[model samples]
Structures are given as C-alpha cells and as structure tokens.
Target: MQFTKLGAFISLFSLISASALTFTLGAQEKSCFYIFTEKPRTSVNFYFAVQSGGSFDVDYAIKNPKGVIIHSDEKQRQGDFMINADEVGEYEFCFANGMSTFAEKVVDFEIKFQDENDIYKAKMPVQPNSQPNTHVEGMQTTIDNIDSQLDNLLKALQYYKTRNNRNQATVRSTESRIYYFSIFEVLLMVGMAFLQITIVQIFFKGSRKQLV
Candidate 1:
C-alpha cells in the first residue's frame, strides 16, 4: 500500500530492439497506456505511478515513451500505468498530472516478471542463471497447475450450494400440500353429519306421535 515516488525509487535504462520499454495508463479516471513489443516469446513488465498537480480538472501526457499520444484523460487523483518489456533488461515508465492541475496524488509501482517470485530472483544479477536458471517452460507449467486447481475448487463449491437449495424448495412444497389436504377432509366430514341428523329428526317425530 506504499506509493513510492518514481523519481527516488527507479532509474531508466536502455536495451536493443525498442530499448526494452513501453508504458500505458489504465482504463479509469485518469488515463490508459499500452506497449506492443516486436521481440517474440520473452515478455517483461514494470509497474509505476506518479502524483502531480493541484488545481482545476485537466488531462494530458507530459512524456510518452512511444511518442504517439499513448494516453490522455481527466484525473481527480494520481495516475497509474503498466509498461511491458519484450526481452528483459531495463525499461523506463512514467506518469504526470501536469504542472498546475487536479489534486495532489501518490503513486506506487513495481516490476512484475515470470510470476510474482521471478522478480525477486531477477535482483541477483552477478549470479549465474539467477532468474531463468531452470527454464521458462517449467515456470509456466507451475503457473498452469495452480490456475487449474483454483478453477476446480470454485466449480465444486458452486454445485454443492445449488443442490442444497433445490432440496429445501422440494421439502417446503410437499409440506404445504399435506397441510391443505388435512383441512379439507375435516370440513367434509362435518357437512355429512349435519345432513343425516336433519333427515332423521323429521321422520322420527311422525312415528312418535302415531304411537302416542
């Protein structure tokens, strides 16, 4: 949650074929940026942020690495961007809220490569095969396995909940039907008894007067 300043934390570096750097803003309040690299197979990413301006609302790009108006939008807070590097080495990424505009902002950025852990391994440069010591295929395989397990777990939980809800609904319906049937039977029996009593009272009264 610490928004580190790009000026103090990171420095720019260059490499072959596109200088190994491209930056883009997000699809939100401030702006959005994207980098398309020509180098195949290998890919790298650097995350960065910056806080600038404190006045009326405005949107513009101070420096776009690609030099083609990469992104522009009105921002109320700070700006966030993600840059991609196709071959590794060093890449430069930046953001600005103009000199006199918007509210004060804070930014925090980090480099993400291979999976989250690969970045830590990248720090040891003087060592042999520090980052990709084993093989990129192996790292990708591990990531694939982890993703599969997560998907299966989510599916299993969803099915269990759906079945339980179905069972509860069936039980409720059956109980309601039985309750209504019992009430109807009791009312029918009472009606039959009342009719029989009326017929017997009229006939029996005539027989009693003749005997007297």
Candidate 2:
C-alpha cells in the first residue's frame, strides 16, 4: 500500500515538472518561447545547455511582459537562472545564433514555474493526531522524501545526456578535421613530386642541347 501511494505521488510530480526540449537553430536565426504568469511574484526557473555546434555557445535574452529585456547574455555555453515574474502576462525567452554565419546549434533547455500559493497549498498539515492520523502523517513524509529523490535523479539523467551529446559532437568535429588534413597532405606531396620531376627533365633537356 505504501509503495502504491509512493508511485502515485511520483506520477503526479512527473506531470507537474517541466519537460525538457531540444531546439535546433540555423545560422543567423533566433527562436523564442513564451511563458505566462497569472499572478505576480511567481518564480520561474530557466535552464539551458548548448549540446552541439560551433563553439557550443549562443546568445540568450529574457523579456518581461512589457517587451523589455530584463536579462540578456552573449556567447553563453549554458545557463541556469531564476526570475521573479512581477507582471501578470506572457514572458519571453529567446535564443539567437547571429554570431554564427554557417554553423547551426543544438540546444537543450527547460523552464519550470513555481507559484507561491501552490507551494503553500501543497504543504502537508501537521497537528494533534490520534494513532491513525500519526501513521498517515508518517507515510506522507516517506512519500515526500521519495518524490524529492526522484526529482534529483531526473536532473542527474538530464545532465549526463547533455554531456554525452557534447562529447559525440566533439568527436565528429575532430574526425572531420583529421580527414580534411589528410587529403590536403596527400595533395601537397603529389604536387611537390610532380614539380621535382619536371625540374629534372628540364635540366636533362638543356644539357642535351648544350652537348649537341
């Protein structure tokens, strides 16, 4: 019965948590996402990482409901930010790759919103309890602990995924560089050999003419 309740709580937490998303930005392109806050003083958490592409960096901007830029950065590889939503409207988050002329970028990000009222309401009540009530309270505490652990696990998984993607990209870029360098080396050697042969032939021809 305890395990069943814990599973249900975990499911609920999953539904409430923000989902991670992947965004591909073409060269000189900008992408934006909108988040709405119904009440003032809501907490918004923004997390992002550049998983691949040139230099693994991008420009990011956060705008409030009034279309004013509140937070902005340039050539950032990753960021985690918390914003206080003071206005009750749609806020905008944007990512731009204007610095890159031909290299596209792959970015992973997530946004989570926590309302003060919701947090307050979610708190379990503690009061003078009989035997049955005490038992129920203890079970609720265990469920809460499990939920917190699961959330941490989810975050760890996301971090690993980002690292893996970046490593793979690095490997591919290195291989491409090596491949092109090898081709260039071969071409240079062939050109040098041809030049030497031509020089030797010209020398022999001039000598023969002189002898004649």
- The most accurate candidate by TM-score is 2
Model 2 scores what on Cα lDDT?
A: 0.79
* Per-prediction CA RMSD (Å): 19.2, 8.2
The alpha-carbon root-mean-square deviation between model 1 and the true structure, to one decimal in Å, is 19.2
Give each model a TM-score: 0.33, 0.82
What are the per-residue Cα lDDT tens digits for candidate 2 across 124-145? 6656753557677787788778
Candidate 1 C-alpha lDDT tens digits along 1-212: 11222434433432221122223333223432333333333344343333222332234442233354434455433333443343322223335445443344334333333334323232323456556556665666776687668746844553454345445645666798889888888888887888789879988998999999
TM-score of 1: 0.33
TM-score of 2: 0.82
Alpha-carbon deviation at 212 in model 1, angstroms = 7.2
Off by over 4 Å in 2: 1-17, 116-132
